[model samples]
Target: MELRTLGYFVAVADAGSVSAAAAVVHVTQPAISRQLRQLETELGLELFTRGPGRLSLTAAGQQFLPHARDVLHRADEARAAARTYAAGRLERLTIAAPTTTLTDVIAPFLATLTDDDPMPTVFESDPREAYPALRHGADLAIVTEAPRSTLAARALASLPVWAYVRDDHPWHGRDAVALHELVDETVLALTPSFRPRQILDTALARLGVPLDRVVDCSNPQVAQALAAAGRGVAVVTDDARFGLWPVQIVGRDGPLRIDLFAAWEPEHHAAETLAALAARLGEFCVERYGPDVAPAGHVGQMGREY
Candidate 1:
């Protein structure tokens, strides 16, 4: 089927009704409905179940949804690639990143770009989804851990994890606390999808230290807020600006750390620009978090030929 038909199908799937889809696609309701009918006929499948107020996807439609989206994404990428090549230079850069990196790393790095430089677009997503968006078309993705992909990556920083407590709390003023020491404490944690939460969960599981209560948060700021309100012990990276007392999470060797990376497709036309951005990001992290947190030998390490 035509790519426009796939776009119509995806809009209907997202909107759940023809009238809504028409509004989104900037077409008349009858036009969208006719297109949907033709698409179903061409595929020889009933893609949707008609109803008075809303529409729902059929089993066949559910199976087809992801592929339709992929087709639309690739089509858009092809158009962008062609335009970039015709222009003989990159015109814009799209970077996907987790929220933490957006706040701590990317925002500052973006300020350093010259006005004539290609304007950067930032898409905030979960760390797990960021790299996929990059692979799909985003020029770069900054994530907390190494992604399981063939994309070229440059390590940026490695931040030590800490347990934050209110000044009035009993754990305040402590230099460090072993994993077992937190067994009976209610812990404020980032959501399980985040790399830090995964590491904390695995370490606690291995140490046989069952957390009394786990308060899940979306970002470090929220976790720190909860800790300051005496809700629970917030597990976070070292941030002196938050004003919370931080206790190092001592592991068998030493403090727990999480490495962050800037990743991009190796063959991207803007590889040199991406490498420059990665180096700038590394420097920004070092300036904000200190040299200890900056990954060793990360400078000038991007865009290595794969």
Candidate 2:
């Protein structure tokens, strides 16, 4: 019935295996199992069903998971608040940013933080995971699409997608290309789980264009590098390009537009502060990729190569 037991139970449930949970929680499998069993015994209910190689939650466990998580979260919050009050410094703000958009998109607003406030600690995690963490405790989370769960704070901004190509690519010099024309060209895409991939697939479907899929990369950075190498073309935000990855904007597509936003708990110390932060992030993006900037000439000027 200890809090640590509930923590272990939640971890095991999430990992779907005692061994995996132990690895993540930094304990042995048997230890985690023992603690969970003890908690189950104290509660007079079967929390988990243990098989030869399977670990699954029982009905009671399924029903109790959310409550256990809330208890743990509230406990952590109380601890953090007490520490913050004593230390006279808001404990470090932990923010999650989409790996694809964090640096150039979200970092500038963070730069505005005064020396008195501790710099935010940034985490790059799956959007699915990041949203829940923000609702539970993370100070902020940046996402490409609005998450559906009511537990989350809310969407801060909606950003659109832009066409990105290699500097040396044939289309680099072009101001824009017909959306349907891109289907004939080699396309580098993110894994299907990524929002960009879903949007691209849907847009191509609507345009009645069959895409020539060439490279499939999970990491946006790798995809950007592939685009830079003239391997294929990808659509991404200017924030994703940053300074490290070189790219050229061939043009924009209406269907390719994406919104990038921040989500945070309203009950937190500075909910309004997060909104202001979101605005600054949006401004930074507009400054770099807004309508006024023409495509760089060093990039190719030719039309479609194919």
Each candidate's number of clashing pairs is: 0, 9
- lDDT (10s digit) by residue, model 2, range 1-306: 677888998999999999999999999988988898789889898988988776898998999999999999999999988887565445477888777666666666677767766568887867788767776668877776654444234333444445567665667666556677676667667887887777777776776777665577877777677676767776655444532232332223453555665566645666555555555555566566674322122211111000
lDDT of 1 by residue, 168-236 (tens): 888889888898877778898998878888888878777777787888998789899888888888997
The candidate maximizing lDDT is: 1
| Model 1 segments more than 4 A misplaced | 1-89, 238-242, 297-306
Residue 184 displacement (Å), model 2 = 1.9
Pairs in steric clash, model 1: none
List candidate 2 segments past 4 Å from native: 1-91, 149-160, 238-255, 291-306
The local lDDT score (0 to 100) that residue 276 gets in candidate 2 is 56
| True lDDT of residue 305, candidate 1 | 18
**Cα RMSD for predicted model 2:** 16.7
TM-scores for all predictions:
0.66, 0.58
TM-score, predicted candidate 1 vs. hidden true structure: 0.66
